[model samples]
Target: MPSAPTPALPQTTCKSLDDWNEPTHARRIYGNTWYVGTCGISVVLIATPQGHVLIDSAPEKASVAVRQNILSLGVRLVDIKTILLTHEHHDHMGGLASMQEATGAKVLSRANVVDVLKSGKNDRRDPQFNELAGFDPIVNVHAFEDSSAIKIGSTQIQHIPMSGHAPGGSGWTWQECEKGVCKNLVFADSLGSISDDSYRYSAPDSLANALRESSQRVAKTACDILITGHGTASDLLARLDGAKPLLEPQACVNYAQAGALRLEDRLKKEAVK
Candidate 1:
């Protein structure tokens, strides 16, 4: 699958790219999975004979580096067949519009976020809501349900609803095999109870309640390897760089607990406020 290189993005005058997109080397996580994003964010690649699957994209400025890294790993942009987003956050999908154009891949997202993606507007239902900065509008998006198992060649990706940190947030899971041993890799979505000053995670807020349930469900789910949307969340870079072990049986459990605690703490503060 030979394809032309992704076109260069003109250098923007803004300082955001320099701050958010710390240049980081890309590397294989396990088997066919690869970590190919900036230091502050996470972009994943799963390759197969039919094509490849890309999970998340960097901020707009970081997209160039991401595409370069993909090429460095010998993956053609056109080989990326399916593009999935963990949420509607700009840091996660700012590059998606251009990425979709570059790769000519089908963009799949939760049905609820289709409008936000197409319009390049903040999702009013999101905790951050009006505080969010819009990204470039994406086009030709297809909706997929949580129960749908998206298959491309030998790879199968499943979605797990985790709409609390933000609307349309989700976790993804897939199996990766290495040297006769296979590990269930989970790309857990952001679980931080972040919000604008006006928002609260208390029971009255429907989104907050959803997060509570999501954390409980995620805590119970078992997986061999966990890769969070933020590299720092699971110490992704450390694990990939050999500073820490990658396979921890209780990773998801611990992650969920930590997120739940954060949400609880936020709620307590909101009560006081």
Candidate 2:
């Protein structure tokens, strides 16, 4: 099949991070997992006996809120033992450097993302590199590979690579137990094929295929509760309110399938153009 021509990168209008910083109260989504991010982005906290593990740092400007949200939950910033990332996107990791410095927590992410994180630069392959601003650089990050398990106290987090949206796009799966009831939770990465109008998923060297494959892999995980990088994608607010069931055995699969469909549709549109 002939690949579509790679479109020129566009200079999309950049929106203020403030616009995305609508304060969202932190709450326990389930077991030890807490939602500490803003209304638009998602930052999760998993507490253990030793300390806490934080996932995704939101944007830099919004990090103060993230910190306050954690404090509001009665957790001390110094007790945050580890910081994990979903990917190297600014929205997800912009606050990491500051958070790491404040808490002195070890940072972990996929090996592929180390350079980008350290350099505070977007990968040239990213569609929105021109539009997105670089974040503060992080140093001495511990890198892991696919299916690697990290154990802290009694909590074990499995790292799953879900590349395409970014080279190091990843997910984390862990079992949380509360009152003798345990649930397998998966914090899946952003699955949407989002890009500037100048980018094409159908391009010859596009990450489309890897994205689809990773999405499918995430779907196969045993997920009792599913959350994503974006709060709306998983109905995080509703779920936290107890209006939604905690055990959604099919949530992971369904989310992956829907993302695949959206990507397929996007490719079709590009073919016609």
Considering every candidate listed, which one attains the maximal lDDT?
1
Q: Model 1 compared with the native: what TM-score?
A: 0.91
TM-score of each: 0.91, 0.90
lDDT (0 to 1) per candidate: 0.83, 0.82
Worst 10 residues of 2 by lDDT: 1-10
Q: Worst ten-residue run, lDDT, model 1?
A: 9-18
The TM-score of predicted model 2 comes to 0.90
Best by TM-score: 1
Cα lDDT tens digits, model 2, 1-273, are: 111112432212214223457666676777878888877788999988888899999988888988987877778899998999888888888999999988899998788778888889987788666677899999868888777898997779998888878778889999977799989999999888888778889999988998899888888899999988886788766676676876788999999998899889989999999
Task: List candidate 2 segments past 4 Å from native.
Answer: 1-19
Model 2, residue 218: displacement in angstroms?
1.3
Give per-model CA RMSD.
4.7, 10.5
